[model samples]
Target: MEIVASVTNASKQYKTGDTVITALQPTTCEFKKNELTLIIGPSGSGKTTLLSLLGCVIFPTRGEVTICNQRIDGLKQKELANVRLKNIGFVFQSFNLLAPLNALENVMQPLLLLGISSKEAKQRAEEALRKVNMENRMLNLPKMLSGGQQQRVAIARALVTNPSLMLCDEPTAALDIKSVAVVMEELKVLSTTGKSVAVVTHDLRLKQFADRIIYVNNGVASENPTEEELFH
Candidate 1:
């Protein structure tokens, strides 16, 4: 499979007066295209930080990040923003939809910002909703939907852009088993459609769907042991 993202000796540190906290230690990893990988770790283990760096939301204090063969770490803010807008799709744990907009409108926001005509954006948005099997809820506002329904809309929004990579942070954390299964199924289908999908999750129930698993501890990551390791 093609490599979608590569990180080498990446680290992030924050200063607090005389003290400095290293949020992420030197780490190297790569995510492959059309794979669903899980980054599993406890809180404050740099899971979200790693996702931020991968998505170009925040630059690493040291080392390099290459996405799709491009050296993204050294790019200017404007260039990074453009890269993210075009190549990265984000699904937050808290379904970040606009309360004022209905499901369809929320899904169209990205296409709209990309300069697509409103009519075209709406048509594509409907198609995305259909992909998530949420076409019937397209006219409903976020307030009118359940947690799983809202997340389905968020997934549709992320997929509508046809991004090269999708970053999901604790997507199943706030959900029950039924909702988690629903969301994971949608994510699996989304990954099958050719996008590299990476999720930072603590739910072991979702591990079976991952092509690869990275277990993070104390701000560092390592390849997780197989299911045999859990029972042995």
Candidate 2:
């Protein structure tokens, strides 16, 4: 398998006046193509911080973050943004769709930001929606779609970019059982198609879909956690 993204001895810290808080400890991990890796932990467990590091949303205070084999920890903000645009896709718990835009338009937003022409963006967005079984609802607004349908559209938006790595945060948190199954199945299938899928989630039901699991707690991360470490 090929590594699409990785963090080596990466750690994060925040300064609040005279106080310094550590969000993540120095840790190393890799996310590979054609695999689904789950980052699981309880609330305030540093999983989200780990995800943010992989997503290039923040610079690691120490160590390195590589996406598509490019070292991004030292890049300027504009350069980091460009890297994210070209190599990464993000899915949030809140769907993050535009209330006023229809599904197709929402999916097209990323391509449009990349300066792709409307015609090309539309064609690609349609294909992405089709992949997630949302082609029929392309014209519906977020307000008009069910929670599951909206999530599918969000997936399409992420897929439209054809990114090497997909980072999802609490993707199934807001979903019901059926919707969770549908979303997780979609992500699992995507991984098999040669994209690295990393999800930060609390939902244990998603474990069945994972090819690998990363457990995090108290700012520490382990690639292979023990049963006691995972539950205690």
Candidate 3:
């Protein structure tokens, strides 16, 4: 499988006055195309930090982050933003759709930001919504949609970019069982279509959909965590 994104000896830290807090320890991991990888851990674990690193939302204090084989850790903010817009897609637990925008408009926002023409953005957004089974709700505003529907719209927005890596942070956290199943299945299918999908989630039931599992605890990451390490 092709490596869409990777972190080598990457770590994150925050300095609060005189104290330094480590959010993530040095860790190396690769997300590959055609795979669904789950980063699982309890609250306060470093999973979210790791996801942020992969998403290029934050720079690693030390070490490197590579997306589509380009090193990003040393890039300027504008350059990093451009890289993210081109190579990465992000799905947040909150859906993050603009309340005033209808489904299609929200999905069209990313492309519009890239200076794509309205006609082309609309065409691509429609196709993306169709992929997530949200075509019927194209004109509905976020307030009018159910949580699941809004999430589907968000997924469509992410997919509209045709990014190589999709970083989802607790995507299923706010969903009910049926909705969770629908969303996870959609993501799993997406992975098989040459996109690398990495999900940071706390739902153990989601393990069934994972092609690879990474466990994080106390700022440490383990590719093959023991049963005790996962549960206790």
Indicate which candidate wins on lDDT: 3
Mark the regions of model 1 whose C-alpha exceeds 4 Å error after superposition.
226-232
Per-residue CA lDDT of model 3 for 36-91, tens digit only, reads: 99999999989999999999999999989999999997799999999999999999
TM-score of each: 0.95, 0.98, 0.98
Candidate 2's TM-score? 0.98
lDDT of 2 by residue, 1-232 (tens): 7999999999999899999999999989999999999999999989899999999999999999999999997799999999999989999999999999999999999999999999999999999999999988999999999898899999999989999999999998988899999999999999999999999998777888999999988899988778787777
The 10-residue segment of model 3 with minimum total lDDT is 223-232
Clashing pairs in 3: none
What is the alpha-carbon lDDT for the whole of candidate 1? 0.89
Between prediction 1 and prediction 2, the one with superior TM-score is: 2
Mark the regions of model 3 whose C-alpha exceeds 4 Å error after superposition: none
Looking at model 1, the pairs that clash are none
